[model samples]
Target: MFEYSIKENCLTNKTILVTGAGAGIGKEAAITYAKLGATVILLGKTVKKLEAVYDEIIALGLAEPAIVPLDLKGATKQNYIDMSSTIASQFGKLDGALLNASTLGELTPFTQIHEQVFSDVMQVNVNAQYLLAQALIPTLLLTEKASLVFTSSSVGSQGRAYWGPYSISKFATEGLMQVIADEYENSSLRTNAINPGATNTNMRASAFPAEDKEKLATTADIMPLYVYLMSDDSLAVNGQTIKAQ
Candidate 1:
């Protein structure tokens, strides 16, 4: 796992947004950020799950988190625009955004890939990310140091036999990260991708049903990379796809 020695309250007064905040790694990241003194915005499709996380954050006496229930699959460009505008209005600036929402789509041979499944994965994994970032750029740029973290996988860089749409979407994700990072190289905004290797997430279970979950790394184990990318410590690192294993 990527290791970093983060101090207490490292993220104080920072307002960070996390997608897929309802469960798994996203849930851990959101709570972790709050614990570190960041006021987090939990963005996810499930209201109940978001509420659960929100309640947990409040109970822990951490920063109060907000919930934005949104389904990336069906959200429009205007939705992202408004969301970004609201974040700017309410928070003054967005210090970081962890774009972690994604779909597994069935793993299948390239020739056997279903049209609908491919479209669904691309919509959530690629298009929504692009639109959200586009809308959030102005707000992100407003902050002195802004981190934009995109989630990736091992298949993002290399092709695998049964990964299909998920693999192709991750390749595009890396491409997107590089393009934005290069464009914003000298700006206040920093862009990067984190390929969280084989964590014991619900998504992981679906990907490898037969594997033993006990041996896989948990969300807590991979958060160092997550925190490092979002902290000022990584200001010099951009346009890189780092692996958390």
Candidate 2:
């Protein structure tokens, strides 16, 4: 498992935004951040799941979390800008944002890829990320130091057969991360990507249905990297894709 010695209350007073916070790695990260003293903003397409996460945070006596119900596929740039403004108004500044939500389109031969699947995958994994990052950058700069993390995959940096649009989108994601990191090299905000390798996520299950779930690393096992990226500990770490294995 990835290791980082996170201090207690390392995220105290931080206001962090987590996309896809209703499930999987996103959900775990949100709860972990809250426990470490951040006021978490849970963004997801499902309102019920977001609410459930909110209640879980509250139940743990962690910081109270806010919810933003949004589907990345249908969200417009204006929607993101307005959401960013609301976050700025409500929280004063955003200390971090985890761009963890992504779509896994069908796994098919290159020649067999559907146009709609490609579009949907690109919309969620690339376009939405671009717009959201654009809208949130200013607020992220408001903090003395901030982290903006994009979720990536092994296939992001390497092209593989039949990975299709998901793989291509991740390559774009890594590019976006690098570009933003370069632009913000001297600024308060830093950008990076995380490649969560072979974890027991729903997406992973769908992609590799025959795999043994018990053998794969759980979200809890890989949270050190997640928490580290959000904490002040990683202020100097930027433009790198750190793997959580």
lDDT tens per residue, model 2, 1-245: 77888789999999999999999999999999999999999999999999999999999998889999999999999999999999999889999999999999999999999999999999999999999999999889888989999999999999999998999999999999999999999999889999989999999999999999999999988999999999988999999999987
Prediction RMSDs, each to the true structure: 0.6, 0.6
Report the error of model 1 at residue 146, Å.
Answer: 0.4
What TM-score would each prediction reach against the true structure?
0.99, 0.99
Model 1 scores a C-alpha lDDT of: 0.95
Error of 1 at 133 (Å): 0.6
Looking at model 1, residue 90 earns an lDDT score of 94
Candidate 1 accuracy as TM-score: 0.99
Residue 208 local lDDT, model 2: 96
lDDT of 1 at 227: 89
